[model samples]
Target: MVDNQSREMAATDPSAELVRLINGYQISQALHVAATLGVADHLKDGSQPSDTLARACSAHPASLYRLLRALAAVGVFHEAEGRRFSLTPLGTCLTGDALGSRLDYARWVGTPGMWQSWGNLLHGIRTGEGAAGFTCAVEAWTYRDQHPEERAVFDAAMTALSRAEARAVTEAYDFGHFGCTVDVGGGEGHLLKAILLACPDARGILFDQPQVAVTAEGVFASAGLTQRCQVAAGNFFQAVPGAGDAYIMKAVLHDWDEGDATEILRSCRRVMPATATLLAIERVVGPPNQDPSGKSFDLNMLVQYGALERTAQEFQVLLNSSGFDLVGVIPTYSPLSIIVGRPAPAA
Candidate 1:
């Protein structure tokens, strides 16, 4: 009762929002702990006593009860009369077996590597270098490559995000006209699978690093696309597969700064046919004080990769410099937008 009164009082206070924002890490960490313990999965059946949940999760009963009640106060779970808890609508998204679930993403964000990098955000701002270099002694990609477990977690997180965004992207744009589509740096082929499923006639080429490309074979085979989709492995900075009617690089270019991003676009242009279209799926930063998600994502890029999300104008410049004309920017239901480009006319 006192807690509820305090909450109401805080809600009416002008500075309460700022205080909550400052303590946002508590919510994030709590969610991470719940996700890591598969709390939502266990709660999917029905409400259970906190002690039962703790026993199932191998957690301390008192500590787990405290965590669940806190999450309940935030609407992630529901607290009943005897310390029993049930999954709320928001909590359901954390279930590992659910389609488009954010389970892996929750796990990924709370990893020590990500925590350490974000913790050193001040260093990144001062030095104009990624915190990954300072914290892990390497760039983000190299750090993940060296840590196999972390790489797997990161890959799963990417795949989870792709699963959630795939339908939105496919619905926003048409790929049926293209005879062949190439997914550059497509991880685990979730987006590519969604595309092929939507456009039955369009064959696909899933391209990525050798180690990454191998994992997509199973994804394609399981999707019954092995005969129609070919998994190719190589470096995108050097070259991409040729003859694709449409080439897609989703969430790829944002990992690099201007120079390297331009080089990637150029590499795509070198192999792309005059008739082929280029699609860069990424978040476009919005005007000042708006689009908090995009702005925060830009900061994440800065901290982890020394990169920044581009605006529409910046995307146009990159495309033009890479011998392509910016065709259009297509928005989807998701945060990502498809920035379309086509080969420029000869001089």
Candidate 2:
């Protein structure tokens, strides 16, 4: 779609694009500040002058005005007469209570620790491990547990992602065949709840760590699924509860490296009935030089968890080694792709 002149311009002046890329952090930080200060929420009713927002958010007026000016330049907000700022579509998404809001997500990603961890991305790449101790020895959850407020924000951000992606997954796969679908390591049971809603006749089991199971139980109860769904607590690396026509693990395996990931899968294999299916809902990395969401997320897994998003062939190999047969991948409406597997035949 590019015209020859546009192509020539890019070919001649790469500095402009490079500078834009370098300044990307400015935008991220701006959005983080907006989300933390609830700037979008403050302007929800209508446009307001920077002074009003500064007073409402308890921030310095001049500093807040400068921030808003920067954001408005980036199209996050629109500056109008009287120096009033109105939320643009992108800015509205920062409001805490907006549908599928990413406020907590912004705050969590922009946390000081997270920022420092990302700064060591070069070390992660050089050593093939997380330089900031974000890998298995000092997991991200360890940091979360130490910071309760940040943990809450992390949970909220996860819930937001689930709210956005769950329905797409529900539409992508048929749950009717399984009488009891167990969401292994499912936090708060959002995806399972969505599946149960879509397939009214199917039942669900929310399996997770004890703390997560407690929340899952409450979520199922609130969804009026108490009778149809149960909460089972266990350590996935050691064992998973032995029950279900199908087991679903979404965004779980990418948190661990191959050894740990295999161990977790083997635990499921040990408890899985021969007739059961294992559905791994994850982002499958594509070819090189392409800008796929999974590719960028792969880098995130690398620096944050020392994990890698696998190609379909890599997944096939992993599943084959973990006592499962690789069945094809089914792409969902979202970025995630479902890697279907079943128990391998007896040796």
Candidate 3:
């Protein structure tokens, strides 16, 4: 809810505030354009004249300057004397190689396919289906495969988000006790890499599609964990190879509807030993009338995958149906919660 003080400020100029809200997409579009032009990366050397920056980014000088002017008003850049602009702290985050960079993420979500898909939000609400009718994760992946550049952008965005969440998850969970851990649908193996780094004694398995596994292998070699971890490529809906003391799937199940989620869980369950444990890491939905990131994520799931972020009880039911008992939910510094489960005892 908007606080009363904030409401009062908006109330004083309701039309202006309402119009700003209505036109919020313009800011997003500006950010997308800036990121796509590599503006932050170009400014990394130092401030430059708008004409020079335009030449570097291969844009019309006058138009580039205008975009920077708008962005600077929003604190993304610093407009100096004589049409020179420099990267602000916020603008630096758009640098491709910057730590925690969101450049690719901005570009990815702003791509025409995604932009138009989100525009079809009403269709999803009315039909309970993606406007494009994506019925499974594979369809989306296949679409990405056909667009190599967009796929690369999407992959980089996932990598950035994984890096952002990895430290919080590793710090919150004690992986030291598990002899082995398997990261199902682990993209680029970042989470598993963090786990292995934290628990030096633990060997790990990173599983995903073959194309994704190639990248994960590189990540493992770069981390000097090639010997300690193995990369296995396959669909989770079919099977997840390599048994381990623990299995973890982060932000995976939320990409699926209940039937598909259960099938994926059952695939994991078949491989789980009686003593083995499972963890589903996701942002759990909160109560009614409360705004949480999960609520926004749920809408994203609806528009993208026809899925929903689950509550604790919803997760418990999913686990129970898959032959596991939900034990506890562990809090992380991130929005993600680790829903812990173990195989049920003989009936």
Q: List per-prediction Cα lDDT, in the order shown.
A: 0.92, 0.87, 0.88
Give the lowest summed-lDDT range of ten residues in model 1. Answer: 1-10
List pairs with backbone clashes in candidate 1: none
- Per-candidate RMSD, Å: 1.6, 3.3, 3.8
| Better TM-score candidate (2, 3) | 2
- List where candidate 3 sits over 4 angstroms from the true fold: 1-15, 132-138
Off by over 4 Å in 1: 1-9
Report model 3's TM-score to 2 decimal places: 0.90
- Winner by TM-score: 1
Colliding residue pairs in candidate 3: none
Which is the winner by lDDT between candidate 1 and candidate 2?
A: 1
Backbone clashes, candidate 1: 0
Residue ranges of candidate 2 with Cα displaced over 4 Å? 1-12, 134-137
Question: What is the model-wide C-alpha lDDT for candidate 2?
Answer: 0.87
Compose the digit string of candidate 2's lDDT tens values, residues 1-347: 98999878986787978887789888888888888899999999999999999999999999999999999988999999888999999888898888778888898788765766777889898889864474334666687788788788878888998987898888899989899998989989999999998889998888899999998888888989889998899889988877889999999988888888899899989989999999999998888877457787788787777788998999998999899999889998788889999999889
TM-score of each: 0.96, 0.93, 0.90
Clashes of each: 0, 0, 0
